[model samples]
Target: MDLTNFLKTGTYLKLKVGLSEENIYSCFKKKDLSKKYYYNKLDKNEGFSYFYGDGALEIMVIDSKIYSLQFDPARYPYILTLFNNIIISHKTSFELIIKYLDIADIKWSFYQRYCHSRELTIKTEENIFIGCVYDKGDYKLSKFQVFEDLYNGFF
Candidate 1:
């Protein structure tokens, strides 16, 4: 599915990354797709929401450039059935994830500092860390986050 590109570009169907907001809006509008924008107190923080199926891509845009990307597989119907696509889910062990990423030598934490819940983080792509959050300490994957700007509290 070229998920790596999707992760990088923050758009499905192979859209160009680092494009202007005007360009993106024009492109999707021409294709008859709906998009939403959100802005908060921080001008450094702006987001665009593009909904497909039950899931949506909440892409962070700064200075009209795509900065970070995340996928909501929880709302996608085919996610669980596609077990082989474990890259986006927490269907495997944390140890195995670290082993697969070849970063086992680095310490693995049972809990994330932000949430105080057990979490596992492993590199999925260049500078991209996929974190699986286990809220109840069941050691099972409850949700996932695509972390590009780790400083933004996404870890």
Candidate 2:
């Protein structure tokens, strides 16, 4: 995946395991606070400025069943960490997109580059979680693909 372009246009969808909408919103607000603190550190190191400006994040309910909280790349990690520390604090599953495409019934391949490169087929109706660590002027979100039929595998 093109990490640069991906981060630029990608939006994150975070699933709150067992929290109410109001609780999730409150926690997210606190997470944004921490993001501002960490983001300043990131900025000093020449990383992307991570901040929750107006409309940077939003909450939506789809189909009267699914509730999601969306955020930009800058605030994504912070929100995840907030859920981890204050809420679950153990295991969390969130999805990331390299880029948004219009086609819904399509398949794509995700690739990673290191000393060698590797690729894998990304199946449709699957959400992915990535573990990322920032270092040496770059961030790496490890590849994890979860099939829609195997939702329990991630939770």
Specify the highest-TM-score model's number: 1
TM-score of each: 0.52, 0.24
- Residue 101 Cα positional deviation in candidate 1, in Å, after optimal superposition: 3.8
| Per-residue alpha-carbon lDDT of candidate 2 for residues 58-150, written as tens digits (9 for 90 to 100) | 443222222433333343233323212322111222223323322232233332321232222232223333333444544443333221233
Expressed as tens digits, the lDDT of each residue in 34-146 for candidate 1 is 44455654553556544443443445556667555555444445353122354544455545555644532333333334344355554433434446667555455443334
- Candidate 2 regions exceeding 4 Å error are 1-15, 28-52, 62-66, 74-150
Worst 10 residues of 1 by lDDT: 103-112
Model 1 ranges off by over 4 Å: 1-17, 22-34, 41-45, 78-90, 99-116, 140-155
Global CA lDDT of candidate 1, please? 0.45
In the predicted model 2, the residue pairs found to clash are: 84-89
lDDT (0 to 1) per candidate: 0.45, 0.31
